[model samples]
Target: MAQIPSPYWPKGVPRALCLPQVPLTHYLQVAAERFPNKPAVIFCGSTLSYAALLARVEALAGYLTQRLGVQHGDRVLLMSQNCPQYMAAYYGIMRAGAVVVPVNAMCTREEIRYYMQDSGARVAMVAQELLPQVMPLLQSGEGDALQAVLVHAYSEGLPAQPASDEVPDVVLAPRQWADAPGLHGLEDAIAQALPAPADHPGSHDLCVLPYTSGTTGHPKGCMHTHATVLASNMASQVWRGLHMDSVFLAVAPLFHMLGMQGGLNVPVTLGATVVMMPRWHAAAAARLIEHHRVSTWAAPPAMLIDFFSNPAASERDLSSLTVLSGGGAAMPETVANLLQTRFGIAYNEAYGMTETASFLLGNPLARGKRQCLGVVTPGVDARIVDPQTLRELPVGEVGELVARGAQLMRGYWRNEQANQSSFFELDGQTFFRTGDLASVDEEGYFFMRDRLKRMVNVSGFKVWPAEVENTLYEHPAVHEACIIAVPDAKRGENVMALLVLKPDFKGQVSEQDIIDWSRERMAVYKTPRIVRFMDSLPKSGTGKILWRQLQEQEHARLATSPAQEIP
Candidate 1:
């Protein structure tokens, strides 16, 4: 069934868009041709013009193909914080007719090993600071398919003299390149300036494989082709009325879908300027916004909260901002109202997953609902369906939010079981199950009710409980662990663990011990902020832990007690 036209749809915006048919790199190529002297990326104090950026991209592409032995359709790992090098390497890998597998810069050695093994990526581009994590895998010969690592220093994108005191110390730190057998410096590779191989990837070719974790405890790659990614990029540009002149604040982490689209892909495709932030600092972000006259900012709720909370932000000239939007966790109603009342900027919340290439739904610029998921985006068909029966539900009835669109991933890479469970056909159209409980209002605005997946939203990061639980079980003191979401005054939700310790280590181990151990094993967001001792966990007849029960109990306990700050 066709969705009813939304009465709140923005004027002059079409319900559907005619997306470009070429590969994603085509846009960067065209942008360079049209705007050779224009600034493409602004990092710290240094800037890279479109002509200069394209030269670096093509050089890296040439080195990857000619020297690194990268081949068409081969997956290459890219692990780095947001920088000009990240952009160069990202497009370079694709320009080489290979797949770009983005790994979180914060990922532990073991986590990166899993990505390397799973993706069978032989080549990797990593930051100088993060090279230690990948070195062991290469030296030990444990990274079976991983052959070489290309290291980039953050300082490569920084100017000789300080651009501003706002530049983080980490970015200003001098390069400390390690001496390893397979480790190569990115500067050396680009200096070769080898001719790029012929472009072969088409619109339908695989371009990126960004991973998303599930109940399985392992991250699964979402296979996104050029066309699939372009869908969301084009849709976002058109829906948000973004133009070549628009200046964007690229503070969001580019590895994630949200940041990849809003921070990098969208702006580059439009021939716009993007001011990059290697790491989030409210004061630095504010100064950058003021200095560059940033017009659009794609910030998650936590960043927005931090920005507004900073006293320095108020002193900055911020009237240049025209658009403020993002979604990972819902924006607190208070924060939303504050933004509107103080800055006259509406907080436009969007909805998407890695499988959707970042954009699926968004509030119209002119008319938006507070704390709502907005409407189905251009060319997207979203429906609330009864998860068990696969029957479409009526408006206002909470059910699983499933969508079919050009932006959806081809499927989970090499995981037939996950692909089978994640997508289904309804009325001859394939729809990807979002695993989120939502309902649409009479005006066609969708509201989030709950999540069907066993996942916790820490600020904007998705922490799968099962994945965290598996890591916790690795601790010697832990016999069994159940991870659950608990209310957080600041982060919206935080991970909490209920652990059953071993008989001998029960009295000797402390909650802090487990937390400290977990920090080394998993990402910081996945580490439990609160740990509780449980003699035994509530379980089903099948012996599966009843996590939902404990989650409800935790919420009830917090409701009656004075809210405490989450450490």
Candidate 2:
């Protein structure tokens, strides 16, 4: 029996004191025993039984260790769209005692390289659609740490179409370097590998390296232990009243924290069925909900926005939905009301981040206080502190939100500076400082006040300023660039880039061209929405781009600006 110390065991938790530290694979074991024949995952029309899913994961894990030489604590990046392969790769990595590093499939080569370099990832299992972006990284010296690139044929399990004379031409890049072997074909790897008994990891074993744009500048890999993930999953399950038969609709991308923890891991932990989709399409989501009789949905506000705006939504039956939760960003009050009035479902507002597994707070259903983020979750401790003094604030005062719990991440991987600054000892308890500015009321309900940093939340996605500026700097016509978040009626905040043209070139590039350039180089959400040419951006005496000043100026401009319906 493993004796790894559990990171999360709240004071009142009976199991916390003497909890047996088991491997991450134990979640699958419990699920298999509870409901072996239950549908564990449903992709397109194909459903994998819990037993079948566990078998595949075991086989893949065996191949990862025996064939690929993946060792414990090795980082394996899972870079694919939402698919069963993503799920398999995730559990497979955990079973192999390797860390799962999930990268957004829509990310460009430049962005992917950063994660690979930062996480020191050795292997990447990528979708065919993303091969162009990933292949360059694999070939380039930029990702020297990366060892193998496994190309996944995406349409393997999806419904097959009739053969047509017009074959879809996918423009694959020319191989520029000596191709390193050990590239596993997605289906072939699973087919050829034999199922080995589960390899259980200890509680303290690192299960995932989820990259979060923390308070420290760029994206940092947060080391989530098996205990951290299990704690988070248990907290969410209790908060949401989830059960074994809970059928979850997972249209949100599994690569993201919310989708992975809430949508994928939670279902598997609870022996529930997760009906997943590659991308979030309102019509497709509604169809899945109707067909599968989905009981739960965990998505961002944008999905609900799309659902109401989608013309085909009215045709589908969505009455089976019992638990509807929205996180990534706050849900609009009007949108929340409309969901309850029209669809007879109220949205459960949640607060969480990648560093905290996924969720830290979940508001109960139909509770009409739109502004509040509900109470602190069970097994979690939250405190408000004065920003300047770091003194704990009373219940009603607004201050920086800080949390301490078992679900909190170990720390930024090998970044001691960040770890020291992020964690502070209060009454012998080390609390993780969450940079988000919020306030707690008398009822213990929390409300988001504002951001203490310049980070932008675009449709539930965190758009780091440094990442955006890095992408904008790539353009030859651009000499200086500053990306700021401007308030939007629809999206909580939209990226607005202030550009200073190069000395030689003036008025040669258009805003649309800049947008297009960014679209080709970066992820869609990270791209700037409004591009303004400027000789110089507002800067402080220290020469730092005054992002706050820019944000205030933009807010002032938008305040008096004519109100136009956001289309």
Candidate 3:
């Protein structure tokens, strides 16, 4: 298997060879040293210079090491939205030689508990609003190993607020937030903290633990070492043409791989300015970009659609944008065309997951393509393999997309069975199975056809139906549950649930009632868009629901009906 060059490669771009075997923290240290006064993070109308950002990172790293007793290789959960605190704590954990485990702030208590137990995290840095969820875990004795919790308050850093009308009034009003037993304010800890002892980790030292949902019915931790994750960081920087001068818009949540790489990690690596927004508000985002003259923005299709649809879009000066890349879902062809023809902005699309740090395939920055995951990146060997036979498929034949890259995760943490099932050795290279049904063109560009994994793509968010089904089962009325993907013109696919109620509760609950119940128990994207009552769900002889049959039936129904708009 020879390495194939991408025909879509930007003319000036050189195929990436080996990245410098630098620790992930090395990026920030280098940037701060070279340009101490340069702005490393822009948040809430305030700028954290390289010197200031590094100082905060050093402080937090010191606090974790000295006060919290976070030793090398220890997993520290970071539960927060996209904000300055997320950035400081993220790199700080790695700087102290501890692993960073980022959990979605939107996660319910049950979901948070699972992540805490699975990762065996001993400490956490959480956003102020989310402290309520993370607090219960620490108090429950179930999290005995967890010693401390650091709270990141966005209200402290936000230049001004009422960021939007939906923001809670309590959240907007100020008060004296402080430290208590097992709880510490991040700001207070940083003030008294010291720079951690110089600890240079090996290329293989695990630095990040991001959980990804798998076929095994739960989210499994993806162990990424400094060296492995660095590959994607550096490659993304070069591939997207980021420089010290680039200003990034940080709208994507930092917990996700794409945002962690493009919005935070890459900027630190290049000493670029990252304008951080704690939440996604189209108007606020547009204003920040115009005010800061942002050069790069990494986002999903949903954000793009919303940002463009904003009436303020007509007034914003987005001419400073030079790079816009996204993954999780492809930008619709018409939308991409409109962007290029009307705004002169080339949307650089990429494909990656929690497994690959963030990149494995990406559309070239120069000759960008719509709806195509670009050619295999430098130092990556991607192939379309028959899902059943595990044999390579010819160009244009759809199959599971498997890839081996420098940034690939070491393996799913503590899940040997999943590790065995997800990775296979082919041509002497160990490739991670993407679970995506796709095809590669003769030019080496890959196009997605479908997902072999039971996951739905809602506005570029991966929603595991099994996880949703598990949550739905918690409802008292649900006797049996089957979650399936329904055709959604805007979301690409949305979750639709089939439920068999307890005989006594048959007419007790409404479809809207079940939908509301499920929403509170799981992530919003995982909530069912449509809930249908069923006397009994179609099942296999083994007692498993026949998900595929139902999925196909829904496709037929949708095919015959006129599609509805998302709004």
Best by TM-score: 1
| TM-score of candidate 3 against the unseen true structure | 0.79
Instruction: Give the clash count for model 2.
Output: 1
- In angstroms, the error of model 1 at 547 is 12
lDDT string, candidate 1, 448-469, tens digits: 7656866689999877665576
Give the per-residue lDDT of model 3 (tens digit) for 1-567: 554567667766657666787787888889999999988887665677888888999999999899889899989999887777789999889988889998887788889888878888879998777877877787877635467898867766655754445443434545344556799888888999687768766668999999875555899899999888888887777677678888888877788887888778888888888888767778888888888898888887646855775778778998988888887655655567668887899888888988999878888777766677888877788898899999998888878989998899999999998999999999888889989888888788888765676668899997756456656656767766778888786778888998888777988899999888877778888888888898877742212367778888888987998876643
lDDT of 2: 0.74
Clashing pairs for model 3 are 362-374
Q: Per-residue CA lDDT of candidate 2, range 1-567, in tens?
A: 111122332233333222237656787878988888988888766677888888778888887787777888889989877777788888988888899998877677888888988888878888777767877666666536566776666556544541221222221222223335545676667887765535567889999988874544677889899888888888787767788888998877787778887667888878889987766567767777888899998876656755865766678888899988866445655566677788888888888888898888666543535755666776677878887888888767768888877889999898898898889987678888888788777666777765667578988987767557755665777756677888887888888898888767787789999998898988888888888898877642112356667778878988998975533
Error of 2 at 113 (Å): 1.8
Query: What lDDT does model 3 reach?
Result: 0.80
Cα-based lDDT for every prediction = 0.85, 0.74, 0.80
For model 1, state the Cα shift of residue 293 in Å. Answer: 0.6
For residue 229, what is the lDDT in candidate 2?
Answer: 84
